[model samples]
Target: SGMLITGVTTLLLSLLVLALAWWASIRGAQMRSSLPPGPTPLGLLGNLLQLEFGGLDRALMKVAQTLSRNWGPIFTVWLGPRPAVVLCGYAALRDALVLQADTFSGRGAMPVFQRFTRGNGIVFSNGPRWRTLRNFALGTLKEFGMGTRSIEEHIMEEAACLLGEFQATNGTPLDPQRLLDNAVSNVICSAVFGKRYGYEDPEFLRLLELFNDNFRIMSSRWGEVYNIFPSLLDWLPGPHHQIFQNFEELRTFISEQIQQHQETRKFGEPHDFIDCFLDQMDKVLAPQDPESHFQEETLVMTTHNLFFGGTETTSTTLLCLTDSCPAQVQAELDAVVGRARAPCLEDRVRLPYTNAVLHEIQRFISVLPLGLPRALTRDTHLRSHFLPKGTMVIPLLVSAHRDPTQFKDPDCFNPTNFLDERGEFQSNEAFMPFAPGKRMCLGAGLARSEIFLFLTAILQKFHLLPVESPSNIDLTPQCTGLGNVPPAFQLRLMAR
Candidate 1:
């Protein structure tokens, strides 16, 4: 009789706890009825089971289409129990990201980046840290020739070197990935490290290859899974582990650079961003302020952030642009600039077709479909949803790029999208390849300059021919999620 009484009492306590939890859930849901509408989610798992099969970009689009029909332009989706409010279509994204900028300026937690950076760098930090780093970086970069003619000289020099490499190929088919990587990486290396590496330098090649491998995996399905369910996937062994390894290797490389700068850097006369940062560190470290973000680890991560951002996306876009419509680009180059001198930024206005083609390429690719997730800094009302502080927000960039209201034939790749009926370059408010508002890509100016200079220089010297027939060439990306990575193909740089 004593044993039966004890068991009955324990069971009653358990039942009481479950009843309380159920009551709390119901109460919370009732309180948040004004929150954006979404499909009812299973506990803890949320919508992961529904999103497992297709690319996250496509799946999200489908969800947006289905939910927006009932919930309107802005709706909620539970990414593993955490509710993320997505801004679909052009108007919704522009309103949240541009109009209410400060409230939505907080950077969301990107698991892959957070694991590596630990909230240190400009790319993935929030609040005061983000403002400090971003301002310092912009000011320092401007001093070092970002968005200036001084920077164009650096890019043109790299372009000349790249031209030599292509000339060396002797009309044979070559994989342009490594060559393009070397050229683009050199431009950023000049700004960050105060020097550029030789194309054949083993150490530089290894670092570039590491970045490439990480980018490939990061865009793969495994990378998407890691982003959505980091805690669950952390223990499970997979290619995601390689991403961590690559990050460590990159960290080591950056550490070596910082150590060398610390030992050799001269005061009052800084050469690059690292030197400027060291100068700032000297001033700030004297006070030993607890809130100061000038630590050595921050330096390493920021350098990696700049280098990684500067290299991959620009090079990948060049490859895709050249592969997609080489003949037309070359024809424009021949007509306008001729094959006499390397193309410069000043000529960008003169060559309307070339400018339009580059713009079209950026629009067509939509490299970062889901712009970096943002967070609410405070409790805010956005598009009828009463969102709590720290709610994750996604600005669906692809929706803007593909909005029918903004461009004619949004799905098709046509240079005319960026051209007027008179055949001059035209700008579109919805053509936000670099995104818009305060959080727009800092390197946008540099990237546009690089793409223009390098492609025109190459076109001036040689014709970019594909290994396969033009009819057989496909422009679909190999992976599509956070970023759309263009498919790899060899090109014959036949001398013109």
Candidate 2:
């Protein structure tokens, strides 16, 4: 018993010594390189306490604002002993992301997602694997009608279904989020699975609910804690476990879809994104070839990436816009679209107010505010600070959108930010809701089409009436770490 106790004590002491060595090494790295300065970190915990106040969404933006005043737009905050160089404001973001695109193109490690993907997928991968998968996925998505009018027609069709669902609400108070999610998800389903599921399909509903629930948990404070102390949380009991369960379910669903595609696929005649990918996999595979990115696992992860990306942000943006500025948007839709036919992408040019409103909604809410973390591909100089290779970067996209120098009223929800002197739909470099540069969202075009068509179709068919007074509604998100998920509220969809 005495010898056993001695052995355990020896192991504990060794671990403590190793931890000290690691902490010392991190401090050494900070001292060796001229990293931008911020509040001093507390040993291992870092500035988690400071950045985790209220909600990470608001806290991170606030921290950047406060630090930028002293440290300029580029500054550093230690996220559990690992320092992250945050790029705040429009100029800083543009200079680094746009100017030095290649150097800052690496995908940073996000523990929450890394656990699920294991760095296998495009979203959280870097270098050759990422490049190969991303290019293939982009080409396939485009061939399957992502940016062109072919995809636009698909969005419009989904919009019609969404309108029907809203019409069936019978003008009673109802939460439109699930209906919006189904419509938005079906757009990606068309591209990936080559078929859209009905709103009442059990499998489709379960997948949507899984994505929604995972997003909610990830954006909560618990998610933030897990990211910071993953090793500790992995052993402890918590809500973070649910994120893995959700990922497993999504993986299973995607695997099933892939198997279905493999069995029924016609060679060379690609029906959809999955069919195209399978063809690529077959072409790349050889008896002697050892390395390949086009495997069944890659297909599954990429498909999930597409589905998750396509569903969440666009639907949340639509939900926020409808909940906040419904009356005014409906006014614009009525004046421009008139209730006769569905609104199309071409109509976007004529409806400057509606276009401007959509842009402003994305700006005000800043969905995925921090964006997926990026990594420095190589040691580089930025804004007079030395950022090292593999340094995690937070673009702080919310900061860019709300930069006071760029916008007239940065805080409030005003559509004029995207309008010119003549009230035309004007573009701004500062407006980077889909982010900017080499790693910009692959589904930007699809998301834009979905948001515009779905929103206009709903507005054309019915008027959005808030269950509570607009003034009483809280614009602050329910949880805000990874993504800014809006608070739950019902709306009365009165038929025009």
Residue pairs whose backbone atoms clash in candidate 1: none
TM-score per candidate? 0.92, 0.94
Native RMSD of candidate 1 (Å): 4.1
Could you tell me how far off, in angstroms, the CA of residue 322 lies in candidate 2 after the best superposition? 4.6
Candidate 1 per-residue C-alpha lDDT over 148-259 given as tens digits, one digit per residue, 9 for 90 to 100: 2399999999999999999999989988978998999998888888888999999999999888888788888888778878987999999989999999999999999999
Range of the 10 consecutive residues with the lowest summed lDDT in candidate 1: 23-32
lDDT of each: 0.83, 0.84
Give me the runs in candidate 1 sitting further than 4 Å from their true place: 1-34, 52-54, 146-149
For model 2, the stretches where C-alpha displacement exceeds 4 angstroms are: 1-32, 146-149, 322-325
* CA lDDT, candidate 2, residue 151: 91
Taking the tens digit of each residue's C-alpha lDDT, what string does model 2 give over 388-422? 88888889899888999999889987888888999
State the lDDT at 251 in candidate 2: 94
TM-score, cand. 1 = 0.92
